[model samples]
Target: MKKQVVISMLGTQLDQGFGSARWEHWRPTVALGMHEDFLLDRLDLLVDERRYAKLARGVSEDLAQVSPDTQVRRHDTYLPDPWDFEGVYATLHDFLRGYEFLPDEEDYYVHITTGTHVAQICWFLLTESRIFPGRLLQTSPPRKKDESVAGSYAIIDLDLSRYDRIAQRFQQQQLEDRNLLKSGIATRNAAFNRMIEQIEVVATRSKAPMLLMGPTGAGKSQLARRIFELKKLKHQLPGRFVEVNCATLRGDGAMSTLFGHTRGAYTGATSDRAGLLRSAHHGLLFLDEIGELGLDEQAMLLRALEEKRFLPVGGDKEVDSDFQLIAGTNRDLHDAVGAGRFREDLLARLNLWTYRLPGLAERREDIEPNLEFELERWSREQHQRVTFNREARRAFLDFATSTQARWNGNFRDLGASVMRMATLATAGRIQVDQVDDEIGRLQRQWRDVEPPSVLDDLLGGDVAQLDRFDRVQLEEVVRVCMRSTSLSQAGRELFAVSRQQRATTNDADRLRKYLARFGLDWEAMKAARTTSGNS
Candidate 1:
């Protein structure tokens, strides 16, 4: 007879507070193997709790009736903290050093049922580390009531050879979905059209050091990822896209974290670790908040860009890192350079392929599409289907068009507003009444007086006075000139000077000088005076 396949049944009763008893009655079940003929091995059900052990023992007795030789061992041990890939790898290394578990070539399968996301990531790491035997099997909880009680389960079979491909496809799908969701604000505005075009270009091009400049919340990072996807779809490149915020990489840590470090490179350098650049080799590296990178880091980055090589911290050997670099920043890099804060050479390299995303106010046409998109997202998040009523829609359009809400925070601000409205209108329909309070609140928060105009500044004497003319004369001249036609006409019509009669040489010269000062001629003065008089 074939050797009995060992199967483990792991179950956990989630604490549902007052509802725990009811939920516990419907325990989840798992089934394993290709034929699904394998029964739970009774010897594996080991428990320490007296009452629980008695209950488990009773269950084992029933299981034994079906499969007498199957071992049932249950230990009252706390489930391992959801496997952490990095932590597990470190632990496995230690275990190996201590010769705790000997490696074997035989096929072994470990079935996990309780932990969710953590379990998945841990399993992925284990497969990646090549520590697990055969492929890890993940079983889905049984569906039907009787089936669940009878131990029905969905199984996900992992093939090690296809792991990387599957992971890549999964990541791509997720990224595509995210982009579609975020860019849903359907805008056909010229500015938005240009942005889309630029994104497409970036996606198709394998050129490095792309720079994305825009105000905060303008979707810089989203655009970058979209470009990455486009490239992947077009087969322009093959590799994972990694994003790192320069703002988070501070001081020496930033350099080491980015360029990698050899063991004993620094005080805490315990292992020869691969940095993000090395990890992202043959992939895309997105540097967000590039402006926050310190001067030293900037110099190092510039050198790397120029030489295509960088020395890891405390390592003399230069490592070659050839990855497409995409950077984003809200600051004016030119200003940063002027202030001696940013490296001019680095900026020049990044400036080669630069894209500036316009803020929402500049692309008002996209607001409605974005709103609809947000509504969809909010509905999905709240687990409620909802729609905006005619009045609410009208109110939103009116507010969007009429109010000069700076929207300084751009798409992010709009998204937040949509989320708030969706939350308040979770009754399946959004109404004007439901959104009115929020509108009022936003109105108050967004209210801002426009900055005084240049004309106002001129009137307030903030402007420098011309040494040639007295203020009163200049004021009168400006007033009369604005109210009349050309200087000649204004002088003749308003000052009652006859154009036919030859005026004094001094007066004519003065008129010519005045015209020259304002970058006007006698003909322009005449036309202006005529137009002013008619008006």
Candidate 2:
């Protein structure tokens, strides 16, 4: 079998004393001795090029008595500062890369007996990381009575997991990190918790474009902001958080506001303005409702997202903004792409690392905890802490999480509900009666705007006969009638659109006739409303 090869750096001052009989001191190398003494087949000594000749000569002369058959080779290694980690690591890494050794043919050992303190750490790091495929050999000085041999040595083969204490510490840290990302919200939601755990890992490790897709008021914006804050705390982000609601931006204003504009770009050209993109340089750019951006703006936005550069509205030169993006959209971008409203390429670019946030209705179990959070916020903002009576709290939660409760606006609606209860609290306490009143108010408000879910029951068998458009319009009409205390009020609201087209609009007559076509008149509508409220 081939002999074991030992790779080590030459000890600077020790080179003089190594096996030097004139000095009357034992050599660390001689103390280590040769192959048979330490089980080393060959020694690959990495030495300072300036002292190569003397070191090589000394080593060879010493090896004659230690182990004659053990071959010693000297390498002229350059390290200006043995204490500098980069200098030592780079030199060793480059040297190892040039060498090709078959592990099956020979065993390799890294002698940690000779380098500087920093060099020793680099060796451990490199070897442990498998950059240097070898076991570490650390040699200690000989005892007083033992003059026959050099020193005692220990072979260390690294298996990180075998270090139980370190492994346990890592596991504990991971759990803490996960909880931090979750904002310490101990939720019972399994899927949401898993998603939060994944998001924590991604936020901690990567700086990639993230897409937060969900319905309106589903906490996408909040989650994006939380991710930014987490990254900021970790020192991964050093810039500000720039947020823009794409829905509020339109026309030339949208272009100028997003990509900046040169002087004299538009009618309101007073001075050149650095747009939101420029403001988000080296920061996070949250484009909420990104789907609402115009197609022209979409093309420009896409270019900026991919190349980090875009031309101003009326400029010849391109401006650069190096920013990470967190895009939130409630719209179905795929459907928009199909309709030629959104670009497919832009969608593809933003689709990577997409996370879908579930709407509030989907995670009703979390509502109760969030209710407490909202109440706390209300106390901070309004300067009055409020608590609900046990019975009232239970009653409100039952109604809030029920199938009948259409949380159409998601968390926003819930927040509003909590706010109203907190504000109307007498002496900072919400009673059972207050809960009943709020539930009824919410029910009525939701029913008035709610999508027609019971079209079959309202129209009976006739629902199947009507086209989808007519069904939608009729549902709106019926829902309005159910909400209105008077037919004329419902008429006025429903036909407000058509009244603009004509000077005289008989909205009441038009609504009455439309209801007649569906075999439903004014009295039938009131009866249906009564039935709905009772049910």
Candidate 3:
């Protein structure tokens, strides 16, 4: 069995005893040796003042009379004020750091009963931190004069990993926090769920700038706001959250709005202004569409992030405002930096903690939950309940998750589709016919926004050589061909009115000639369509 060692402080007042009556009076250090069940091999006593050397020797001599085998050693740990928490902790920490410990040969215990309350707290901290490499031992005084003078002792182990219930509670709380960051949507997408988990950990632990990148309507703005609310709830931030869309800010107004301006700073300046940065002091500042900001604004923003000081537009004095930054952008900032539209240094600063949110189309598995969420929101705002018929609901979901649905505008499209169907539902019940009509409307909307990238894919760099008129005409023809089954069908749609005026019409031959002019054959166009569908 390993030897038992107790480290304790000498209680100058309580451990006092002299001569013949010392046994009658109950003293803590003397009672320690008188215990029958608890056998200590060695005792390390800490004496704070040099004046207590004689008293410490007397106590050692008294302990010898009760238990001669137990060895007592005195350490001079001089503390000017034992009541000072910082001073006592530093003193104890230094002593523990230098002390030799043999974990295999000895089991150590720290006696907290003899020290002052501050010293007790320090001992607890040191023991809990494993700096002392021991468990805490607390002893209480006897209640009655006839009771045994050894009193009662309890051992406290500070290692919390051994307790399962406490660990589970901490894990459960972390899950709840992650859910709050996601607005409690119960999303089914595995990748999106994992991303939210990391965001929660970073948002709570760090005050550094974060970059949120995604396409439009992909929930960057909403996520930024949720992060701000979570931090504020944790009491990590004290001021209010300030948000601004960089795309809406222009020219001199952008500078004035972000960094504030002094009275008579510009032509329209009437009074002093506290900018968004100042308003967000001790809080969070979310700059949406950050890539849209000018080069000058980017430079100023870098200064504000590195050193919490900046001068306002036309101001002579520098202002101080310390705030956490969260910047959101739909554009690729690396490309913008290369084009000289955005500063590279600003991108570097924001790139430390970057998270890219997926568009709605990529998270198709989460569409059902988000659909339910949007309907609930609509009901809460409009103050009226709406339900979908079984058939209508199935039809809408099938179409929403289908390959035909582009969802180019991401969650914005889903929200708007739900609102349109809800508004048109008769007596709060949406029918199958309404779902069909909504699907057609969505197809039309997507077609209207289809970019010229269709032609770019087919012709590569050759599309750039064509005039604006040719590019538009060819893009439409290519789209019709990809949707049609054959060249003849595509020609009939493209030349619908014009072909009727002709005496003879061979639609396939006409389309073949158009394809030949652009050096694109029918087989190549069909192959590209097949590849696009599989992707």
lDDT of each: 0.64, 0.83, 0.91
Cα lDDT tens digits, model 1, 1-535, are 2333332334434211123243223333212322236543323332335435555555555445445666655545333443565654454344324432323422334455543455446555665565553344445544665553334444445664567987888768655544552464446677667556555545555466889899888889988787776667767658889999998998779989888899999899999877888777777889999999999888888887778798898899999877888999999999899989999989999998888888888778778887788788888987888899998898877787553466767888788888777777756888998678767766666655345422233345532444424544655655555555445545654445444565553444566676466454555545555665676
**TM-scores for all candidates?**
0.51, 0.69, 0.76
For model 2, residues 356-419, the per-residue Cα lDDT tens digits are 8888888888888888878888898988779998998999999988876878889899999999
Greater lDDT among 2 and 3 belongs to 3
Sorted on lDDT, highest at the top, how do the candidates line up? 3, 2, 1
Residue-by-residue lDDT tens digits, candidate 3, 1-535? 9988999999888899877887777778777787787788899999954679888989999889898988998899999888899999999999888888999999999988887999999998898788889898877777898898777778888888887998899999898888888888989999999999999999999999999999999999999999999998889999888999999999999999999999999998999999999999999999999999998999999999999999998899999999999999999999898888889999999999999999998899989999999988998899999989999999999999986799999999999999999999999998999999999999999989977476778888998798777877888889899988998899999899999999999988999999888988788789889988997
In Å, residue 209's CA in model 3 sits off its true spot by 0.5
Best by TM-score: 3
TM-score of 2: 0.69
Higher lDDT: candidate 1 or 2?
2
Report model 3's TM-score to 2 decimal places: 0.76
Question: In model 1, which regions exceed 4 Å deviation?
Answer: 1-185, 447-535
Error of 2 at 240 (Å): 0.7
